[model samples]
Target: MNTLPQWAELLVSFFIILGASFTFIGSLGLLRLPDFMARLHAPTKATTLGVGGIIIGSMLYFSLSDTLSLHELLIAIFLFLTAPISAHLLAKAGLHLELKLTDNTRDLRKKPEQYSDKDS
Candidate 1:
């Protein structure tokens, strides 16, 4: 906005661009990676960082221009907390389903049937 100082504008713009780029790269990785396990790596790390960058930018912009902005921080915290957990769960599910992995992958876990016994 015209009301924002030049430095704040530049900082926000830089972070926003960085965030969008990371998000785009993550999406690209998902499409380009050759295997399911490899593909799972992309959105978990890249998208998390991407969203964090955008959230940081928004938090900075709003904090500087108006009252102390906290919602963005909360969103960032939630993303940080949940992304890895969700990724782990998804990966576990994939493993349980016996999804194809890259040629070089070495699975160390017991068979999915072990999980069934635990669940029972």
Candidate 2:
């Protein structure tokens, strides 16, 4: 006894396709970008948006079918919270390791004597 509009189904499908495209673009950027920081931006930005879009599509589809808000919200929330932290940690670690690139725009390591140690 379900009566759903065709437009709603179409919209949901559109969102799913959009999300998949974003994710694919992100993966391509990760592979094709030249440098570490540049490459870091690809997945962090695009993939996050892509996953968010997919989660939203899931929420809409489930809500329409089940008439319950459900736990898709939690997945979106967790992804938003964690993805940025993971990206930040990755960038920081890369800087700590002093990984260099041909087109590096910023210096990674601190200059010597910038740190003060009385024992020294």
Candidate 3:
């Protein structure tokens, strides 16, 4: 097997570590957030980026060897494309089901007239 140079090795290690850290933080947010809508942002955004980072590291490591690796790139592309759509679907479903929000979260779905000065 061909060996990676010191710089490449360091870069790969950095990506892996960064990815793991983000995944961990995202998972923690999922568990600790007050409600479903509040929690969705953490995993969908942070965790997706986390996996992307690890995929990038894997791609770098493999591409530097005897052959190019397309699997990681495909996975990263699929993930980037799907995460937002899936999160939106999930949030839409939650809203349709009338999922309750924490008191601190304002419901933007309210009718615009509710904000009018005429109400006073």
Q: Which candidate number maximizes TM-score?
A: 3
Can you write out model 2's per-residue Cα lDDT over 18-109, one digit (the tens) per residue? Answer: 88889999999999988887899889899988887888788888788778775988888888899889999999998888877655555534
Candidate 3 yields a Cα-based lDDT of: 0.90
The alpha-carbon lDDT assigned to residue 22 of candidate 3 equals 90
| Top candidate, metric lDDT | 3
Q: Between 1 and 2, whose lDDT is larger?
A: 1
Better of 2 and 3 by lDDT: 3
Q: Which stretches of candidate 3 lie over 4 Å from their true place?
A: 112-120
What tens digits encode model 3's per-residue C-alpha lDDT throughout 53-90?
89988998998875888899888888999999999999
Worst 10 residues of 3 by lDDT: 111-120
Each model's backbone clash number: 0, 0, 0
Candidate order by lDDT, highest to lowest?
3, 1, 2
**Model 2: which ten-residue window has the lowest total lDDT?**
107-116
Q: Which parts of model 2 have CA positions greater than 4 angstroms off?
A: 1-3, 104-120
RMSD of 1: 4.4
TM-score of 2: 0.82
